[model samples]
Target: MRSSVDKAAVKMSRRWKLICVPTVIVTVIICFTSTYLLLVKGTNRWGSGRGLRVNQNTRRTGVETTRNFSRIGNREEKTRENITKVVDREQNKILMTNSAAVAVCCTDLMNLDKDKAVIIGRRRKNKGFLTIGIPNTPRSFGKSDLKRTLKSLIQNTPNDLGQSHVSIVVFASALDQSTRLSTRDIVAGFPEHVQSGLLQLIEAPRSFYPNLSALTGSDLYNRVKQNVDNAFLLAYAMDSADFYLQLSDNVRAPSNYLQSIRDFIKQQGGAYWVTLEFYPVGFTGKLFHGGGRDMQQLIHLFTEYAREQSVESLFGHFKDLNVQLRDAVRRPPLFAS
Candidate 1:
C-alpha cells in the first residue's frame, strides 16, 4: 500500500510541474513582446523631427536642440529662395514677350498732361470715336475688377463699332510699385487689345495733388479729389471721342449696353449728356455726351459744386442755374442790342 501511494504522489507532482512550466514560458514571452512593442512605439514617435521633444532643462543648452532649430531655419530659408526664384522666372518670361516689350517702351503718363496721353494699340476707323475712362485707386480697385470690366466692355459692345473705334484709358493714380506692376500684368493679359491700340494705360503725375492736405478736411478733400479725378478723365475722354463713357471699376455692362447708347443718341439728336439710371439704385454718371462747350462748362461747374459744405445746397444752386439757362435758350433772342 505504501509503495502504491508513493508512485501516485510522484505522478501528481510531475503533472503539476508540467502545468507550471508552460505557464512560466507563456508569461515570459508576453513580457518580452510587450517590452519590444513599447520600444518600437517610442522610436516611431520621436524619430522624425516633426514631433521631436526636448526636455525643458536640456532644451536650453542641448546641442541636439540647437541643431534641430538650425535645420528648420535652413529649410524655411530654402523655401523662400525657391519662391523668389519662381517669381523672377515669371517676370523674365513676361519681359521677353512682344506685348510686354511694347508696354515697357510706352511712355509713362503720370507726368504727361491730359492732351499728351500716349496711345498704344491699333486705331480703328469708324463713324465716331468712343473713349471710356477708368480711374483706379489701389485701395479700392484691383486686377480682377479691371479684367472683368474690360472683358465686359470688349465682349458686349456692338461689333459694328469695332474695338478700334473704342479707346480704354486707365488712370492709375497714387498706386504703390507693386500695385502698378500688377496693373501692368493685368493689362498684358489682353494681348490683342494692347497690340491693337484700343487700350491705353496712363498713370497720374506724382505732383498732380501736391496740396491735397491743404484743400479741405479729410472727408471733403477725398470728395473733391474724386471729383477732380473724374473731371480730368472726362476732359481726357473729350480729347479722343465725341462720346465719353465714364465707368466705375465695379460696374458690369449689359449685353446690349452699346446698342442702347447708339439708339439713345439718335433719339436725343445728339444731346449734351445722356444720364443713365440704374434699376432701383437711381441715376449714375455712366454715360455722357462729350458735347463740345456745354460738357466742358458742366464739368467745371460740377467741380466747383463739389467743394461746398452742403451737397444739398450745391445741387439746389445747380438746379436754379439749369432752369435759368434753359429759359434763356428757349426764349427768342432780341434783335439788337
Candidate 2:
C-alpha cells in the first residue's frame, strides 16, 4: 500500500511541470514582437532625418548659385556707370572752352577727336584765321600737291565764316594699343592751332555681339559702323557742328586735305558734304554698300564699270543703291560729284 501512494505523487508533479513550460514560451514571444515593432519605428524616423538633410543641402546650393549670378551682374553695371561718368566729365570740359565752330567725326585713332580740334593758339586767341584742324591720320600728299592744296586753302577761306573749333571723336578698341601709339605721334606733328577737344576714348568691354562669329565683310562693317555712329550721336547731342568729315587711316591724302575741305565748305556757304576718293591698294577692292549713304555711293561708283548710258538706268541704279536723295545726281551721274 505505501509503494503505490509514492508512485501516484510523482506522476502528479510531472503534469504540473509541462503546463508551466508552455506559459513561459508564450511570454517570451510577446516580448520579442514588441521589441521588433519598436526597432521598425526607430528606423523609419532615421530615414526621414536623412531626407531632410538632402533637401536642405539642395536649397543651399540653389541659393549660392543665384547669389553668384547677381554679384556678377552688379559688377558689370558698376563698370558701365564708371565709364559713362568718365565720358561725361570729358564732355563737360570741352563745353567749357571757347568753341566757335565744331566738326564732329569719329575715327579709330586714340587721340583723333582731341587732336583734330581747332582751338585758338595759347598766345593768339584773336587770330581765328590761323587756326588749324589736324586729323589723327592726315592724308599723305606729294610735295607739289601739298603745296598747292595748302595755298588754295589759305587763299580761299571765306571771310564770313568766323573762327571755328574742331572736335575729333575717337571710336577704337582698347586692344589696339600699338595703333593708338602710332596715331598719337602722327597727330602731334600738327601746328599749335589744333587742340584736343574731348580727350576721352570710347571702347566696349565685350564684343557687341558675342554670340555670333565675325564672318562676312558686311557684318563686320556694320558692327564697326554702329559703334562709331553711337559715338557720333553722343557728340551731336552735346553740340551741333559746322560739318562732319569721314576719314580712315588707310585713305592717304595730301597733308593739306583737311584745310582744303574746311576752306571749300566755308566758301560754298557751309552747306555741303565732302569725301575723299578711295581705291583698294590691292587689285580687288572690297567696298561698303549699305552701311551709310556716303559709303554706298562709293560702292556703286566702283562696281558699275561703265556709266549708265541712259537717265533711266542711272535713276534705277540710284534706287537700287537706296540713295536717300533720289534726284541728287541726275542724268550722266556726274561721276565725281
If scored against the real structure, what TM-score would every candidate get? 0.51, 0.28
Q: In model 1, which regions exceed 4 Å deviation?
A: 1-112, 119-127, 139-144, 158-160, 215-217, 269-285, 302-306, 309-320, 323-337
Off by over 4 Å in 2: 1-163, 168-174, 194-240, 251-323, 327-337
lDDT of 1 by residue, 200-249 (tens): 77665545443666775667776666655655555556646777766655
lDDT string for model 2 (197-288, tens) is 21222333343322323445644443443333333323321222434433332333343444555454355342222221122222111111
Highest lDDT, which number?
1
CA lDDT, every prediction?
Answer: 0.51, 0.32
Native RMSD of candidate 1 (Å): 26.4
Itemize residue pairs with steric clashes in candidate 1: 110-205, 120-197, 121-196, 121-197, 122-196, 122-197
Candidate 2 minimal-lDDT segment of 10 residues: 61-70
Write down the RMSD of candidate 2 (Cα, Å): 25.9
